[model samples]
Target: MTVAVTLLLASLVVGLATGLLFRVWALALASPLVAVVSAIALQSAGFEFFAGVSVIVGCLVVSQLAYLLATFHLHREKHSMEDEVDGLPGKHRQKNIRDQYE
Candidate 1:
């Protein structure tokens, strides 16, 4: 029981961090599901409760960090793309294409 509770709390922390990193409130709301599954899987695998919690927390942190880094990279790529488009020879042509798409 204690192990279950610990795992659940750890998962909640992970979920909260993920939600914050992604700015997605829905992820935070779904944290309990993550916790429950993690607990079950860890128990089935014969890991102690604390160890399972530690592993879950570590995974969560790493995943959230990776997501944040990816988002940053994507934002940078988008900005660079926009700049490239802006520096093209024909501004009117770009505007026309944007308008057509819109």
Candidate 2:
């Protein structure tokens, strides 16, 4: 009950941070690996097999969904900014901050 909710919330935070902070898609592998480890730990802590499995699945689903959502919004933001920049004439174009750093 309480433990499941706590785990789900933690998973959500982790997923969102991963998506927002790390652009590499390959980093999502952490979710599955963590899920398996959590399941095993729960079983060793006296949880039933089915209960532990269910909790792990829930955490994985929550985290992955959150990661997907954050990434989608990030793309949307980037694309929208690009569209604004593209409509400007070359003489009046804003210098991108990224360009300066590069």
Candidate 3:
């Protein structure tokens, strides 16, 4: 496949996997760099380097959009969970280890 097509596919897969399955913000954030590196590695000698760079840039933008969409859903889910937890009667509010005082 051409670098453009390959970059598109790779970025989409990585963005979706990291954003949906892993819900890892950092990884999702790094997907653009990953796409760029993949393009560099997989690009054909006949492919124009400037064209490959443009493809990578396009892929990066799409991946970031995908990541934002996924993270928006995650934030919604998290807020819903927190609301549910806060609705319990007689609850003192839940705290994680990070919130606990030593």
Say which candidate scores most in TM-score. Answer: 2
Ranking by TM-score: 2, 3, 1
Per-residue C-alpha lDDT of model 3 across residues 1-102, encoded as one tens digit per residue = 465676777777677666777655677457747775767665754567787677777887777777767777777645555566556422233444335753
* Candidate 1 stretches greater than 4 Å from native: 1-23, 29-32, 78-102
How far is 25's C-alpha from truth in model 1 (Å)?
A: 3.0
For residues 1-102, what per-residue lDDT tens digits would candidate 1 score against the true structure? 455455555655665456455555555544445656776777787888678888666545544555455556556634555457557635546687789899
The local distance difference test score of each candidate is 0.59, 0.75, 0.66
Question: How high is the lDDT of residue 60 in model 2?
Answer: 88
User: For model 1, what is the C-alpha lDDT against the true structure?
Assistant: 0.59
- Estimated TM-score per prediction? 0.45, 0.64, 0.56
* Order of quality (lDDT): 2, 3, 1
Mind giving the per-residue lDDT tens digits that candidate 2 earns over 1-102?
666777788888888888898865645576877596677667667788789889998888888888888899888745555457666534323456446677
Off by over 4 Å in 3: 22-25, 77-102
Instruction: Output the lDDT of residue 17, model 3.
Output: 64
